[model samples]
Target: MSILKRDQGGVPRADPLGDAAGTTALVLALNKPVYPVYVWFLAESAFQLSLLTALSMPLYLVVWYVSRIGNSRAARLGLVIVGVLDTLAIALIFGRESETLAFLFACLVLSGFAFYRCEVWLSRGLVAAIFFLFVLAESLIGGPLTPITAGDMQNLAYLNITGAAALVAFIALRFPRQERMG
Candidate 1:
């Protein structure tokens, strides 16, 4: 059966927002493992940071699984929470010098708004949470948990930029096309 079709439980499984979130989570899970290679030559702390990121794979996988089980709302929320927490952790570790916060947070905000099309309050709340976290990490707690070389930071920035861009593209592509009104 097609993924978009109803499951045995009669739950609809074709939620565009959920699909986008789930796909994003799956993509992140697949890529997290490769992060270490991106900064292999960096300081041990940097390598350790990359390894820590890889540990979030399971969370992402869970989001995907939830989405597949016809719990799109929960899956979308899971994706948002995971993304927010993961970014916060990285931001705390890399501090203000982490060049990827803007892109990452932008993606999170986009997802937050897109995922709750019918629930205005939920959408606003999600965006507020993302913004609050961004400010807290970028302004209030802008100090690295572990020191990293400039070169290592640059490499990580590149990785994050690529990942964020890919996620944005995926969300856009997965968005349901609306029929134009006459």
Candidate 2:
């Protein structure tokens, strides 16, 4: 059997969700290292944000490994949890001014696409979690963890908005399409 067509056991290898998850993991991992350098370049004061991004790399690797083993649901859950937590961390660290909350919206969209129809409940729960985090960030969290000038905050905001938009677009493009019925 062709390697592309089968696993070592000769079973057909077909796991769209797993493939998507693995690809997401790889993309995130590859891009994550740049965040710190980029943030430092933008504002040395905001370097902590880069550290937070760096910390999330291990979680992405875990997601990749889970997907590689064909545990798509676990990988999906890992991605949602990691994305939600990472966005929340940025919000809490930089406060609302950084505009990092935009990433939470991306997380919400990610949760929606990460699961299938049969896993609707899981998807809903993840969406709710994202919403809850958004509310907590907007209402409960106040002020930046460290003092950052308005200009620095604005730079971070631009970075965040662009990052969130890219994340949402990636999710839309990478996930498998579903048939629509009239």
Q: Candidate 2: global Cα-lDDT?
A: 0.77
Q: How accurate is candidate 1 locally (lDDT)?
A: 0.67
Q: lDDT tens string, model 1, 66-149?
A: 988867878878887888777767666666665557555654555544553345566678777777767666667665667887
Taking all chains together, each candidate's TM-score versus the true structure is: 0.78, 0.85
What are the per-residue Cα lDDT tens digits for candidate 2 across 108-129? 8778876666567778888897
Q: What do the candidate models score in CA lDDT, each in turn?
A: 0.67, 0.77
Q: Which numbered prediction scores highest in lDDT against the true structure?
A: 2
Error of 1 at 1 (Å): 25
Specify the highest-TM-score model's number: 2
